[model samples]
Target: MSDPVDRPGASGVPEAVATPRSRWRIQIIWLVPLIAVLIGGWLAAKAIVERGPTVTISFETGEGLEAGKTKIKFKNVDIGVVKSVALSSDHRRVIATAELTREASPLLVDDTRFWMVRPRISGGTVSGIGTLLTGSFIGMDVGNSTKPRHDYTGLEIPPVFASGVPGREFILKGADMGSLDVGSPIYYRRLQVGQITSYQLDPDGKGVTMHVFVNSPYDKYVRADSRFWQASGVDVSLDATGVKVNTESLVAILIGGLAFETPDDAADDAEAAAKTQFVLFHDRAEAMRRHDRIVDTYALVFKESVRGLAVGAPVDFLGIVVGEVVAINTRYDPVAKQFSIPVEIHLFPERFTSRYTKGDQGAGGRLTADRQKLAQTLVDHGLRAQLRTGNLLTGQLYVAVDFFPNAPKGKLDWSANPPELPTAPGGLQSLQESVTSLLAKLNQIPFGGIGKGAQKTLTDADSLLRQLRTDVVPQARDTLAAAQTALNSANGALQPDSALSQSTSDAMTELARTASAFRSLADYLERHPEALIRGKQEDKK
Candidate 1:
């Protein structure tokens, strides 16, 4: 180097000196590599920290989802990325491996649900327009429940939107689902409180079961004594008057819904224990009671067809819906050579007992005077089967209950004689039989003889009318002509130039002059026409 420049070193002696240009060159070479190393390390650490757990989400279809484009979002914010997608072994589902970031790990709860957000159209809502632009993605609902969880199976079909309500699960067995729809509101004591969640046929496919989710607060009001009914849909009816019913509100009338009602004797303790996840129908105690009731129902058997009996058809103590038809079955009566359909009716005496009775038994199991009154009502107005028409055209018949004043007032004597004829014949079958009998009676009438008699009567009437027109009318006309001829001759004789006319005129003039003298005579004659015959009553004048 030239003259060892005075660049200071650690040893203060002029060691192998470097120029400013060379030093700058050395810094550029060494610092560039170090900074590159630092940048690489930083990138590696970021990648490791951001990397998340790999979860395989199974879906029935991947029509709108993409591997790299689709993201896993929690609450509308992206928290994971889908790395790859492949079909499962069964090929029924698309298994997508998604990476959930470490930051989002805490949000993964046991009850968290994952569903793919796709465009859907339902009753009134059309959602997922954003997916059209950025592509559809899997949505994750991370919950805080402590329950255990497993791999999520994303629904191909969107889950029905149901409000998470605190209620007990009730299984309404043998319910009709075609009679129910979503948003079909549920009623509690006639007050709308919730809606039906869903309805599906039981796995065994014997009956339909309705899944009704009652919203919080109101859900607690349901009790074991609660009864459900199909509250919506058009119920057309016709009687002696023509067709009549309330058929407005087209949607409400068409889409039937379920309603819940509780009896007055519902247990409060049972009502309070009802929580978010409580199951009402599965309780052993409640099940036992239902079983006992079923057993009680089977004890009695009727000996006739209760065809066309409906689900809510009443079993009246008097004239009320104290109970309903639970079921109907047909069994062959070998002696009668006919099928006898027995209707299983359910009764809740607690509902009507209070309304009609009074007095109480003091601390004893025995009933009081009120019980006697109730017994009398049961004896006089106990359940009676009456004929009812179901459909006019179909001629279906049903058994109904009514308290007719003429009905016998005593306990039903099962051993006594049955009615000789079907009770009163009020149903369609009875009407048909009556119409047939009337037609038969009409057929027996001698229509040919009546027709011949009617023809003879008409012929006689025609002959009488012709005789009146030919003989009587002609004779009357001849008499009128003779009178006209006599009047015409008299008019001709009174002509001005005739001799009779001159003599008549002179006589008329003389009569006019003597009219004053004849006035008294005329008045006297008018007063007494017979006086002229008796000679003028001059003495009386």
Candidate 2:
């Protein structure tokens, strides 16, 4: 319609004058708003990407835990934020839903566990308070465990930290639980390398199971052929020595520690499955197989008391601890019609195998395998059972193996079967027999004749005393009267105030001193008869 230039701005004056400036203004107005919208969309995408995925971790209690506040930590660094906390379908557990950053997603392995961090009593565990201020989440540990990873249920009490390792699980029965304490050290060759993990009573409530864990590398050192004993609590005693025990540390002596030893014959299988965790001093099955010798046990049955016996007492084969008494039980034997106690004895054949063959086949071609030859060698080398006293106060007896070359061998079968030799006599039996024997011997003596002779001697002495009284007393009295008459005549001749009175007083004092000396000599002789005998003997010598 109108002119082309007049169409612009619809002003008749000039269309070109306002056109450039107006378009510039319009472009400037729309550019800022579009740029702002694009920036907002980019920020939303970045936030979603940083948030990563939501994972659910279940827990028993959420006491110190807060949803949307607590963070999941890995290696002491914050990695994720907890989204929400809600009850599971059972309503018994709390499930913490967490959103982790994409950077942390790769760290979440199958073995990852989630446990709440709070201030604990024994040692303060402080965490998540930083998250409360910074609005960040806690961290978690994620890695493959050597042992199968178990889902964590919140601990009612504080849980102890333990690293999982591959090892056989053995239950040690009949262990003294009070003697074993948690954190007590376990020794291999007197070197402490492990600690007791935990302990609990068995289901049957008859025994205690001690959980011991050996750290890696050292775990391989412990084989299935290991032997264990309470190294710290064992006691040894001697009559003269009194009680002797090795007590190095107060903690070891009081708390009691475990010891493990490897045998010489143990297989050198390096690839064998290591026993990283084992129950100490229990599990006899593995221990028995590891020991290559048969234990010899003897039941010492006696009608009378045997002297010197005690538990932890040794049964010696030539003064070695071949075995010990495991138990003492009493039963009435119908055939014997007497109550007999069976003392269980255990013997380890490894100690004596060097001298004797194990099997019955006399070693056929091998001289080293003959049992009879071994028995003969022992007898020829002067092997004998010597009765040794164990506890003098308890009167317990132990039969000690001794070498007696000159001792007479009685007529008994040493070959047919090892003869049931005598156990050293102890207890009331020895006292009863000794008393009975003494009484029997006393009955055999001629006591009646001896008593009559003593009575005759007394009668003769009495008759002599009567004779002395009748014959000697009158004559002595006459002599004394004559002496007194003579003393009076002499005194009268000497006169009252003469030098003779002073002389007489001095003479009487001298006589009294002599009598005192004689009394002292008699007392000394009576008190020390041995001194007199020794003086005479020495003089003769």
Candidate 3:
């Protein structure tokens, strides 16, 4: 090929050597495009190696989510960003696709939790205030599982407590949720130690099951016999004892809360395990009350009014309260044709036995037989139930079971459903009966007849007095006047200057003169004879 080219080039100057065109050459313009392509390929391969795992989170609403704008955070540090937000095929939820960094890849586990960070106020707590100034972001709570997950359901409500917080969870079974919500404080001796986490209606629908978390130190205090009660507000009670007010704390008063305490008697009980189940009492009184294992129900039939007596009234034995009235009913006896009041009372025999004896009370059957025999013996010995006024101001009545030695003899009706116990008249009712009997006796007296007889006698006495004043008084006055005139004449005749008194004195003097003359004549005649003249001998002397 070189010789032919040389021969063909003969037309040209043979001396001029025509060299073949150069096969290859470098151009400056092409180098620029080649370098650009090589750099672009390298960058794409690096991006594929460094990219993190993608996750999709379903939310009920997409309120604060944005594509290419919203960020995913863990512990306030950005770990990922939302790539897109789209509705699910069913349109029931919003699906957000987020791209996390390579470092966060291992954190995407089965139990990882996510929630939106926004301003919230609940259960006496304020959170996420900083989110108001900054924007809302996706919050992540790392899980403790090795298995990874690419799909998750976001929580609508934020957790009351964060993961890794030193605490324990417990279950409380309650009749109802009494003013309680998530984040309500749980107190121990009025100190906040925990908070309620969640609650749900029981499957049986009989009660609610609540979940609560207690911090580390306080969690140790929870024991097997620990008592729990609702301490939502001030528990104010006005009863026979007096007015009582109970509360946990001011926070409990504002929101709602629960309180727990280990009873002093049960201080040695074993510590409760995590997720322990407990019964939530309505109040502390019920929670603290000692449970009675043996209960005896009896019916007391009273023949009097139970006006002031009410259900729940204490049934007192001697000075001790042994039971309470469970029910009160009016019953009519068709056979006897009489009405009576039957009060059903639940008596705790253990209360009576524990005061005198200790140890196991007895087996159920034997215990029941012993109680029946004891009750019969007591009834035979004049043990009776009576109603008495407990509070005069409140007109509250209570059952008083006592020994009434003089009470009429009666027997218990053991065949009755709740074995009937003998009842005596109420104290006030006895007093009323005595007063009524006295009034009835007084009413039986014939006061009208007595009054009529008295009136007749008084009329007769008045007539007799009038007759004396009209007839006897005038006759007696006339006789008295005649007698007074005669007395005056006799007095005048007996006076010293009267003529009869002077003539009597003169006659006495003339009789004395005559006797002297006679004595002188006799003396002269007998002067010679002798003694007859003794009167004359004095003259001789």
Top lDDT hit: 3
Residue-by-residue lDDT tens digits, candidate 2, 1-541: 5697657565566534454455435656788989999999899998876766667777776665677778777666777777788888999988777777778666555665566655333212233455444554344655565443323444333223433454332334445664666666666666765666667887888767776666556666666656665656545556686776654245556666766667677765342253333445632233434443344444454554333455656667755665665655666879979875545555454556555545734443343345445545665666554446666687666656556666555232454332333333443555778999999999999999999999999999999999999999999999999999999989876885667877887899999999999999788778767776675333454
Q: Candidate 2: where is the Cα deviation over 4 Å?
A: 1-60, 77-112, 119-200, 206-272, 276-293, 304-308, 332-340, 355-388, 391-424, 427-432, 444-541
Expressed as tens digits, the lDDT of each residue in 1-541 for candidate 1 is 5444444664476567665655435655688889999999999999887776777788878776678878988768888888888999999889888888888777666767788887775422467778888788888766657664546888554444422435544556642455465556666655666665556677988767656667767877766556566656555678899997643235445565556555454543356333222222322223224221211132124453455556556554444455566676677878979775556656453545335434543312232224334434544754345556556787565445555566555453433232111133345556688899999999999999999999999999999999999999999999999999999998988888988999988999999989977897899899899887897666654
Among all candidates shown, the one with the greatest TM-score? 3
Query: What C-alpha lDDT values do all the predictions have?
Result: 0.62, 0.60, 0.89
Over 4 Å off, model 3: 1-61, 83-112, 142-153, 174-180, 200-209, 230-249, 281-286, 293-312, 326-345, 357-386, 404-425, 428-541
User: Residue 364 in candidate 2 has what lDDT?
Assistant: 36
lDDT of 3 by residue, 1-541 (tens): 4665557556665465788876687778999999999999999988899999999999999988999988999999999999999999999999999999999999999999999988988889988898887788999998778899989999998888878889799999999998998999999999999999989999999999999999998999999999999999998989999999888988899889999999888845998999999999989888987756678899998998899899989999989898999999999999999999999999887666665444554644455559877788788999999999999999989999999999888787778889998899998889999999999999999999999999999999999999989998999899899999999887877778877677877888999999999898777776556655453355554
* True-structure lDDT of candidate 2: 0.60
In terms of lDDT, the poorest run of 10 residues in model 3 is 532-541
In model 1, which residue pairs have backbone atoms overlapping below 3 Å? none
| Cα-based TM-score, every candidate | 0.52, 0.52, 0.64
